[model samples]
Target: MTGLAPNVQLFPIESILDLVTDGVLAIDQRGYVLYANATAHQLLGRKELVGKNCGLPAAHGVGGTDLQLVRRGDMIWAQMRSLPIQWLEQAAYVITLTDITERKRAEENLRITAGVFDNSREAILITDSNNIIVDANPAFSHITGYSRLEVLGRNPSLLNSGRQDKQFYAEMWKTLNHQGAWRGEIWNRRKSGEVYAELLSISAIRDDSGNAQRYVAIFSDISYLKEHEAKLRHVAHYDALTGIPNRVLLADRIKQAIAHASRDRHKIAVCYLDLDGFKPINDSMGHETGDQVLIEVARRIEHSLRGGDTVARLGGDEFVVLLRLEKDHECLASLDRLLALISQPITLKGSSYKVGASIGVSIYPRDNGDADTLLRHADQAMYIAKQSGKNCFYIYDPLADLRIRSQNELFKSIRQALEHNQFEMHYQPKVHLRSKQLLGVEALIRWRHPTRGLLSPLEFLRPIENTELDILIGNWVIMTTLAQFDSWRRNGLEIEISINISAYHLESPGFAHNLRQQMALYDIPLGGLQIEVLETAALADIATVKNIIEQCRRFGVRFALDDFGTGYSSLSYLSRLPVDVLKIDQSFVKNMLEQQADKTIVQGIIALARAFDRQIVAEGVETEQQGEALLSMGCEIGQGYGIAKPMKAEQLQTWHQPAIEKTR
Candidate 1:
């Protein structure tokens, strides 16, 4: 009955072995399988594995060797261990198998992660909870110029460039504690003691309880980017030619200067300079020479100027100098130095050239001008300096510039009118005051403006006095007068013509020769043409005017001293020159009858003319009373609105016929 009990104790052993998921087997010392549990058969994928030798692997290696089980076209890794145990009352070995495929895979992933951490381009550093460096990757050593052996056990603060203060680190730690991470740009030093920029990101590794166990920092070197940014900044603010501040930078400096001046209650002078003769050299010698000259000039200016002053090139041959001064006169010394430097001989390519500068200074707040307006005023002043004389400096004068601008417009208009033949000669009749007979006509220039009808010489002539435009217009009047004289002579009107001549034109070296040539060309006799020269003009150089008059007399060309009574040397130079006519200035003639002083001056002028044996013609006689007064003073010839206001040539001819009949 007990033998037939179905081996109840063996069932308990089989049930205990089958309860485990891991494979369990009993093997004999000969390596033959004695007993196998269901888990073993299922894990091995073979039901016939038990009660067979199976040539199973033995646990004979140094550490319990691993065995491979083939199951349903898949291989399962197992860790096998054997130990001696009593199995079925026989000497046997207990074998245990544990599937370890997933554990192996997990270990492989950890190895890959470690490799990636070491091989990354970015540097990786690990620090303990106390902020001391614990480990560093190869890339960390390469980037920070420090080896792992050198960095381990040291604080990461060793790599600090000292660019960040304690406050910065404190803020960084505060951010790290609040956010568990911190990322930003930082400056660090390399092992070679060279500083570098880095983009660093740090993360705190926390344990399960959310407490930081270690700190991991990843950093990338960004020194190249920093250098590039510096280059961009330089290019933006510096001038290419002079290597100094450009307009963009100068604006910033000017702002600072204004602030400083405002605080100190001092004056700031803006000096605008233009080289006097740089253009001619640049055009003639080549741009290379010009560049060299500019370089030298910039160097000299920058060095000679006081510190804290800024000199900037506005481009081309223009430069702007900012000077802070305690007084207005303080600018003078700087200006003197600038002028001296510019005057120094510039030597280039074995050739020496002299250059000068014209500077214009505009004072701040005093002129009430802003930065741009100050520059504008300085430029205006510079032009004035150029006009007065080059190699000098000028202060901005608003009133003077206003007058200059107004006159400049007149000068330009006069030039344009001359070019367009907009000027005409109006002949005013000069008559014998007693007989009322027409003697001759004086030629007066009138501008026939296209827009504004006729304009008298008084309206435009004074602005161009003593300028090249005066000479040009004077020549024009002469040429046109001679041609009119020829036309009148052809028409049987034998009238002598008196033309006004400027002092500049009269004093020219070859005036006599040019007059002679023109008379011959026009086929006109010298007796019919007379030049009316101002007394002041003629006496400017008494010897020269006397010689010129004598030279003209040889050709029978007459000279008259126009505006005789207005000059101081009228009486003194009267005897020295052989002039035929004395045209009294209209100023005295027009007012002689009004004021007794004027009457005395007119009488004295007429007496002097007679004593000198020179014919006198009174001008600007507008009324019969003035003409009668001049006649009473022994002046016979007079021209005025009282005698047919400056008629055209044809109108003069028509009036002459009737006047001749009346005289007869």
Candidate 2:
């Protein structure tokens, strides 16, 4: 009933063919030409096949059967299909020519896409809108141990192990439909019925009508990833070796604990514990053993702590204990009990170790609410505990810094000393008792602190050592000593200023350059400045010492061995060293008169000095008998409380008066 006649037709047939972009050809009952469309000739490559007879083989009108045609070096596909059509009151042949070039290209693309999906290391599956598996690649088959035929038409739930709840699935569906995609972890079962963890990603594909027609899922076995992630988590939040809460987790705990205490208006005790003599153990027993001991110690300390209290190792042999004892003095008792347990000796591997903990106690929300500051104060208190001997704890005394309160106030006072010239240098005059003349004025540092009055190095230097204020105080010492030498030269005094260099100064890489620069800054001669270094640290690093001493000596600056016999080195080191003068440590000088061995040692040193022809200055001589003893033994010089107790710089010029007049 399909009409193609010129008249009496209800509807036209071209309208139906127009719906298809493919080419259509019709033939008459005798196989004679009836009609042909433009695309059909183009598809056949003849371009003039209208009214052609259909008796020829179907391949003749087209390029060829199964033959590749090249246009611009591109393969084009031609397909022929014949159908029966009614036209002119008889059955006619309707041959359809479809230019499947694009379809073939698309097929090739789909094949490549399929190849990739099959070869992928990650499992890939495609499903219909209902989540029933329509296709699965080789990777999915390999991962789930299921063949393509076995999984196809089966829902993805076939692989579910029921590990995820219905709510999780609902959330996944909601997320996918709302966001067009979802990705997460899930537990799935293999064909062998074994369960495994997998990371999964699902995507919904919609048609032009905007309704989801298909879904794509990608997954991977995440068992190895889970193991690795767990390892990193431990390393991130807990110490790897000790398996205790690390600094990050401990700080977090402290912060959370402090916040809770603050809400309750309660006080929290934070104790910082540092193992005493732990360094010696680390050095002697090796780091492996040290780590074991720390783990054991962490366990013991945690065990000893009261329930609900947390003990976190802050790396090394340092630990922090958080006690949220808001009522009654429970924290103190708990801390004491834990500290006692920690003090017990630990036996590790084959060695028995005894290490005491020095604990610094700080109360949070009371002393301070901030976690970092509280930990710092606890650290300071720990040092105080160390000062009171080991195996003990100390509460942070706010008045600790007050002991040097006046000295701190003396910064301005010291500044005034610098400005109004209230500052002066004292000299403990070194006497050449053999030659019996003033040799040198060792510049002793004295701060005419206003509120604190005149303070010696002993009274203020310890504080300087424990703080950065040492640099300021050190600068004053250097500037004032150099100025004194300038004064002595102005008065025609030839004596050198013997200034001591702290290890902090000497080990400073810029020390030699800075000293030379300072000499140039003040226009003072380097020859008149004698830098005295204590023997202990001066010899500790021989290479560094050699480099520094050699570099400074090049500027015509000289060095004297101060506190000579105090170091642990043998005498063989002295004759070969770069030092210019040997000042016998006062400890050796004090016993020289009474101890025959001290006399022999001094005599040996003097004899050795005479052989090397080095200047020998005997220190700490209060008695003339000591001086005479040194002088008779061929010792040449002396400086100590014997002459004057480290006098001010102003006293040095007149100091030579008494000794010079005594000889004259």
**Candidate 1 lDDT, 126-193, residue by residue in tens:** 99999999999999989888999998999999998999999999999999988999999999999999
User: What is the lDDT of every predicted structure here?
Assistant: 0.84, 0.76
Which window of ten consecutive residues has the lowest lDDT sum in model 1?
A: 1-10
Instruction: Report the lDDT tens digits of candidate 2 across residue range 296-368.
Output: 8889887776676778888788999888876747866876887777778888766788888999998876576
In the order shown, the candidates' Cα RMSDs to the true structure are 9.5, 15.6
Q: Which pairs clash in model 1?
A: none
Best by TM-score: 1
TM-scores of the candidates in the order shown? 0.62, 0.52
Q: Where does candidate 1 stray beyond 4 Å?
A: 1-137, 144-195, 199-219, 222-266, 270-307, 310-321, 329-362, 365-409, 449-454, 650-664
